[model samples]
Target: MNTVSQTLGQAPSAHVYKNDVRRKLLLIVVFFILTVLAVITDLLCGSGTLPWHVALNGVFHPDQASPMVHVVMWDLRMPVTITAVLSGIGLAIAGSLMQTVLDNPLAEPFTLGISSAAGFGAALVIVFQTSLVSFLPVDYLLTANAFIFSLVTVLFIGIFAARKGLSVEMIVMLGIAVHFIFSALLGLAQYVANVDQLQSLVFWMMGSLQKSTWTQVGINAVIIVLVVPILLLLSWQISALRGFGEQAQVLGISVARLRMLLLTFSALLASAITATIGVVGFIGLVAPHVARMLVGEDQRFAQLMTMIVGALIMTLSSIVSKMLIPGVILPIGMVTSLLGVPFFVWLVFGRSMGRR
Candidate 1:
């Protein structure tokens, strides 16, 4: 009789839990739809307008369309939209990994000085292209320098964190210090640069998809495709790491090794995107929190939702960047910042008020 009664009592809770799961799954579907819509919007609403059907046709059957429309759609619009999606997904994953591993709400590539380091490297290329070994073309030089410097910054942080015993406070503090150092270096570059070089450096730092090309987009897509499955496979471990913390070690999770592995993975993702596209801010910091809200603490769901949310945010930002001025495209970084700050402020204040 007691067992029967307990079973009956538990059934209601289990039913409620199932309902909650269904609701979150429904929400994920909704986000997926929104992301698709955002991508369509990006394809349709660029500098020159195209009919929806025409854009769709041009995308899939470009040979059937006018050469001008085909080139615009395939060569220009396609690459940027794809780049935005890939960058968004990569950065969101990186940000979530950093937040979980570092146990800091504000943990992100930007906060950890990774993007700043990349900017400094790009600035060097922009300001002194002739002086800094001009064997490679400008585009490759910029990417090479950004990638190298960003990795160097990560190495620096890793060494310091290892020395300091990998405490959260030490990592965050060192990240902040590194960010400031890179910022100062970037400032110096700007000061010494000629007017054209200064303009290029400043614009690159602001970020844009205007420079997106098929090759760059394809490279980012391939890297993201390769990495995401591994991340998803380890999602449960990541979730446990976030929830269990010190207890994770007792549970045989190899907390230190896991942290280092995820940190390197996340940094690599962030550095690749940052190196290629300059700096697209706030999506990394904001997307993961939004995903957490929708998906709770399960890293699998959060990871998927974070990618969708990141893609949606970037696509929307791309659309807004062009539409804000009819003929003038604002930097995507500027648009993201303008949209992201208000959302970020609300999130911080809401969390503080215990309104999660």
Candidate 2:
């Protein structure tokens, strides 16, 4: 007993804390470096006729660069990459929030019904686009309408769950129901769409930044800046509330309020991304988990790492997507899903073994 007591007393408390701090700092640095690399790669690598040298110069000295380089780097590439990075950040944050609130490792923006709801809304606009132009600008009409309808899905879940003090099962089921209904509506709308509308909707559904514009980017940036800070403020509450529902309540946190606020921000974030770039799958599900595993689940580390990891993935995937076909451009969602699915399989089956 004397020997055991002495050995336990020498367990190295200060050393452990110092090592943890060092590891966290190292992870933070790595995330930043990767994010920078992803952005630079996005700028330098594309299918455009001009080389990397001209594209780099074009960022600051557009006059000296070739017209194609200017258009590709600034007009096209910049907006798309920016949108992708922001969307990734938004989705990753949403995923982290859902996982915490739902108390499920698999909860994500799409799983919670935001994507399906937004998809339905976009499909409705696409089906009736020709008829709605007089009421609103063709582009603006579709984006706004989609956003509003997606909010309805989130509201439905929030309201239902909140009424009974916001059961995790209830919210999850509500989201599932919303997904089914919206999916049905989307299919029906697709059935009635004209050729041009169908093509546009299909492409949008597949997801791409091929159509990025300064106006869309501006609107998204405004919404992101407004919404993300709100999310950031809740970071501490989220970390503390990671406990199961009853424990969370006992801890003096309002579960319903937290869920509502987080859900609203998540809905807006997903809507903005869907409106601009369509649905980039698995980002929400995949990114937060990666962050959590890398740096632990403390919300500060989780959120920061989530954003950095997400942005890097999006930017890199986008570059790969464009380069895959040389001259042809594939949808961003396609690339994400292609990469995300394999990663997810590994996360589910393989990662557990490594942890053990």
Candidate 3:
């Protein structure tokens, strides 16, 4: 077995255990430090600023707090921070699972057209100016709508990809084709949208937490809580499935059954965020790689570390983004893409350097 597998397989290979543990420990430490910095930076910046002491006092004791600070910190920044963190965690987990399942280093939420389909769904709602979703509570409706559309898109891709049983290459290609068709539809929707609708559509495309509320955070939290445990539980079996597709068939792993279940789960996870938050890329692609680099290739270790680092990166981005414009909020997708793109580019290029 490779060193990474050895570490994950047996309980007591000291070299494997110690190395894995140490790396995870370091990532946790880094994540904690980064999250704290992001929170502090977010609290300290904005169009209107708060004194550090006043903000600190507000956290521990609500009284004797500056009203402006209270509004900005408790109302504005707090929810934004939470949304960014949770969204980051959700996307990161999705990316890692996809790569493992497809056995492709480049398999990612966006690359496979999942995010594109999601963006198209959200665009249809905003561009059409439809109140179809008005029956739902306003705070959560958009996200719910986005999730529904995303699942629909996923279903289309899933059905197409399920020929002769499920194959990773087929699904990936199906996703790519679906993405192209949806991209054109989204453009058409944008073209017909009025100014207000256009603006809404544009912002959703950019992916920002400026409009986020704690209510949305609560909804996202519930979905993540529901979905993640199931994925983590399947980690060992998933690892075995890699490069052993036929072996999986022989061992009674219902290839089609597993694909359907996983696709539904991934659709829920991805669609929930897409409907609510628009399309935030990179976390789903970048976080998993960061996890693997830190803790080797074990999914159990990888998933945990990815969640931690994804939260950290998003929190940091939101926090730092606040400082960039003082009072104005930058769309978060811009920040993540900026940071995540270069790293991913390097990963694509750096593969030649990887030992086979």
| Candidate order, TM-score descending | 1, 2, 3
What is candidate 3's lDDT per residue for 1-356, written digit by digit as tens?
46876666566678877876787778767776877777666655565656777777776666767787677778886787778878888878777766765668777666556677776767756676443466876555556666766777877666666755657787787778888987888888888889998898888888888788887788889989988888789776665565475477777677666666666666766677766677888888888887777776666667777888888888777866766776677888888888889988898878878731
List lDDT for all candidates, in order: 0.86, 0.80, 0.74
RMSD of each: 2.1, 2.8, 4.5
Q: How would you encode candidate 2's per-residue C-alpha lDDT over 240-319 as one tens digit per residue?
A: 77745556777788877887888777777777777778878988889998888888867766788888888888888888
Best candidate, lDDT: 1
Which portions of model 2 show Cα errors greater than 4 Å? 1-15, 63-68, 130-135, 350-356
lDDT of 1: 0.86
Clashes of each: 0, 1, 7
Model 2 CA lDDT for position 6: 70
Give the true-structure RMSD of model 3.
4.5
Least accurate 10 contiguous residues by lDDT in model 1: 130-139
- TM-score of each model, paired residue for residue: 0.94, 0.91, 0.87
Clashing pairs in 1: none
What is the lDDT, from 0 to 100, of the residue 254 in candidate 1?
A: 88
